[model samples]
Target: MFADGLFILFTVFAVVGAAGLVLFKHPMNGAMSFVVTLIALAGLYALLNAKLIFAIQLIVYAGAIMSLIIFIIMFLNIQEEDLPAEEGRFKYLIGGVIVVAPVGMLLTKAVNSLPGSEATIAGAGFGGVKEVGVKLFTEWLLPFEIVSILLLVSLVGAVVLAGKRGTNK
Candidate 1:
């Protein structure tokens, strides 16, 4: 019962964080909300017994991504007045359709399905850090390296973008 209650609370926090992410006027506040949402998502993943995913969620998302976002925001020196004006109401209408249409279709299809999804275990194998290491390196190596490279590129790009203009050209 206690676990269930906490899970519900975490879910609420995550949803509120997501909404706040959209509604907040300040970029720094929005970034913090994104971190909150990521942490709550980690809790949700842990609740599903996917501890590896939970750790990855916290480390990769809340730690690395949020830090990068905050760094970029500060480097760019985003002020309240520098923020762009909100688009017209039709923009929201278009955004709503873009977001809701696919989600509505997916939900409708999932509900109409006769059999719900089920998890199937893979062939017997070692469980834990060693197993994950082998699996990631053996099968998912390319994507893993790609993500690392992507982060490095993002850091370099941020530095370049934030560098002061040349005066004696």
Candidate 2:
């Protein structure tokens, strides 16, 4: 019962946070909402007994990633005039809903059509840090390295762009 309640609560938090992330006008507010969502996801991971995932979700996503985003926002010192004015926002939103609704329905239908069964208990070492580390370093090694390099390149690009903008101004 407690687990079920926690699941419901965290799921609500995640959904509401995601909505806030999308709907908030200010970038800071959106980033905060994303942090909330990430934290809720960590809670869900904890509930599922994925302790390593829970820790990673909190530390890597909510802590490191959010800090980076907030740092960038603060460094940029964005003002109201910096944002582009949106015209026909309501019309665009309605059009987006029209486009997304059918896709959402189809995905829902596909999920519902899947064979439903009770989840079996995970064996020893499942979701453990050691197993995860081994898999990440072995099977997923190339993709993992590629992702790290991409992140590094993106970070450098962002710094260069910010520097250019500062110099231009």
Cα TM-score per model: 0.70, 0.83
How much does candidate 2 score in TM-score?
0.83
Q: Each candidate: how many clashes?
A: 0, 0
| Candidate 1 segments exceeding 4 Å error | 87-102, 111-114, 117-127, 142-169
Q: Give the root-mean-square deviation of each candidate in angstroms.
A: 4.1, 2.6
Residue pairs whose backbone atoms clash in candidate 2: none
- Residue lDDT tens for model 2, 59-126: 99999989989998989998888866766767877898899999999999999999986757877787
RMSD of 1: 4.1
Instruction: Output the number of the lDDT-best candidate.
Output: 2
After superposition, the stretches of candidate 2 with alpha carbons farther than 4 Å from their true spots are 155-160, 164-169
Evaluate model 2: give its lDDT: 0.89
Compared with the true structure, what per-residue lDDT tens digits does model 1 show for residues 40-152? 99998876666677888888889987898899899999987899877564578578879999999999998888686665564444335667888989999999999999989
